[model samples]
Target: MILVTGATGQLGTAVIQHLLRKVPASQIAAFVRDDSKAANLLKQGVAIHVGHYDDTDSLDRAMKGIETVLLIAGTDEENRVHQHQNVVDAARKAGIHRIAYTSRALKDPTTLVNRLMEGHVHTEQYIKASGLSYTLFQNILYMEAIPQFVGGEAVFERGIHLAAGQGRVALALRSEMGEAIANALASPSEGNLTYQLTGRESYSFYDVAASLTKLSGKIVTYTPAEPATFIAQLMGRGLPQLLAQRITGFVTDIANGQEDIISPDLEELLGRKPTPLNEGLTLLYKL
Candidate 1:
């Protein structure tokens, strides 16, 4: 049986939805921290097992009779590695053979400025050392979250403002990545494999501006900012200090061309080209 952790989140929900299309609900289980949040999964007839990354006993219970576990990376950047290790240890005790983790698609996961990337690097290493067969889906930036990054309704009024100078980022829809993950879970593998699930094409902030302009027909331009200025502006708008810093770091990473690589593995798995940036933006903005 396949068990998916973080089953209540958006990506997890999408993955489970796709999994249901390919397999019976009886063959899939959801490992959630709050069974209350997984009412939909329960209604869909999925086996719901309550668990948390930090709770070994709960994880052990969740892993009962589960052959494969999709270990969704935790959001707590500071304590996530330790939490993932806890799950790994419990999985070993439960005799689970295979694990699939969702990690970022970076050329060097260690060199990034993002604390989240560091956690992923450590977790990946820990999983590799655990002796269980693994699949790592190094996911790229999700196109669906463009509104959150660029500003949702405000972009129409203020255009796109960021510190991402001219670097390119390959984008994929969150649902598509979920589908790819489900596909990986459905197929068993003998050796550890890592797939960089990125968009077929890459785009820069300039490209984003142009797409918005074309879609809105109202001259949406991109204003580049220094990281310090960007952080200050975000803080001025009432964002938390750590959050402001993290958002700025993402722009800086993109400016340095750290996330520009394109990969075909995602499209190869889906048997279709992933959604393009412009098309996705048009749909998002209702242009």
Candidate 2:
């Protein structure tokens, strides 16, 4: 059986949906914190295994007879590394053959996202140390994050305000990332591989603005802000201080052109072009 953790989450749900196309629902298990949250999936015939990253016994029980396990990163801002360790230990005890993990595109310990990604990197190391066949899906920023740029509440009203000066980001659609994960889970390759997944092309903040303007026929503007001022704006707009600071720092990193590069690995894995910026914008506009 293929077990998916965090199955109720966005990425996890997408992964399970893609898996259903290649594997029977009976062969799939969802390890979720809240069983009620996955009632729809259970109704669809997937086995529901109640569990949380903090509960080792739950993880061990859920992992039983599971050949492949996908460990979707938890959303906990603090103590995630330890939480991931719990899942890793349980998987090791269950004797799972292959494991897949979702990690960030670029995880530098010094960056704002480092706290978020440190757990992923640590879990990767733990999986490797456990001697299980493993694959690390290092996914880039999702095109879906564009909505975050617009400020969730005022998105349709004020348009997107980004401080990513001239930096170009290679954004991949979330579904594409899910497809890549499904491919890895279906066919376990020899040795551990870290796939740096990105879109077919890179785009600057201005490019994203232009795409939005063309797709929505709405006047969208990209505004650059200093780190301190950006953080204040986000906080004023109802974002928590911690999250606002992290978002500002990530945008600063992008503005510095730190994540402008692109790779063909995503297309190679899915055998299709990654969704373009305009297409993603148009889809979001409709939503």
Candidate 3:
């Protein structure tokens, strides 16, 4: 059976939904920290295993009889890498022959100023050295996150204000990525592989503004602000200083063309063309 960690989150839930289309619910299991959040999965006949990343015993019990485990990247910024290592160790002890992990897709991980990238990098390195066959899906920025990055739907009226400048990202829809991931999971890989899951075309915030203007029937504009000003504005709105800084770093990375990396890997996995930015934006933003 295939076990998917972080099964309650958006991406994990998407994976589960698509996996159910490709395989029987009996063949899929959800490793979740809270069984309460998994009532839907259980109703769908998905076996639920209660466990947390930090809890090795729980992980071991969950890994029992599991042939493959999809290690959804964790959110614990401070201890995520350590927690990921714990899962990897437990998987090894459980004698699982193969594993899969979701990681960030960047041309050069070193150039990142975002602190979260550190966990992805370390986890990848550790997973490689673990002696288990692995499939790494280095996912790109999700189109669903555009709202948070551009100050929400109000940005359609407030105008797009960010430090991203003309930086482009090959952003793909989160649901499409989940479909591709489920496809990969349904047919497990025999050898180690890494797929840079990104859109075939790249787009900038300017493109986003134009698309919004066209789709919403509202005049939307993009105003690139200085990095410091953007960060200060976010902090002024009550975001923690560190979080504000992290967000700024990501946009700045985009400005520097870090997320511009595009690949056919996503489409290849999906068995069809990935959704275009304009179409995805229209679906995500009703107004």
Write one digit per residue (lDDT tens) for candidate 3, span 1-287: 99999999999999999999999999999999899999999999999999899999999999999889999999998899999999999999998878999998887778887757878989999999999999999999999999878767788679999999899999999999999999998995779999899999999999999999988888999999999999999999999999989989988988988889989999999989999988898788864
lDDT of each: 0.88, 0.81, 0.92
TM-score of each: 0.97, 0.92, 0.98
59-158 in candidate 1: lDDT tens per residue?
9898999999999988778898999999888888889989889988876655676656678888899999999989999998899888988888788789
Off by over 4 Å in 2: 107-114, 152-159
Cα-lDDT of candidate 2: 0.81
lDDT of 1 at 235: 100
Which regions of candidate 3 fall more than 4 Å away from where they truly are? Answer: none
RMSD of every prediction: 1.1, 2.0, 1.0
Residue 113 accuracy (lDDT) in model 1: 65
How do the residues 117-187 of candidate 2 rate in per-residue lDDT, one tens digit apiece?
56666777787888888888888889888776766536546766776778788998998899888877877
Error of 1 at 160 (Å): 1.0
Report the number of clashing residue pairs per model.
Answer: 0, 0, 0
- Alpha-carbon error at 18 in model 2, in Å? 0.9
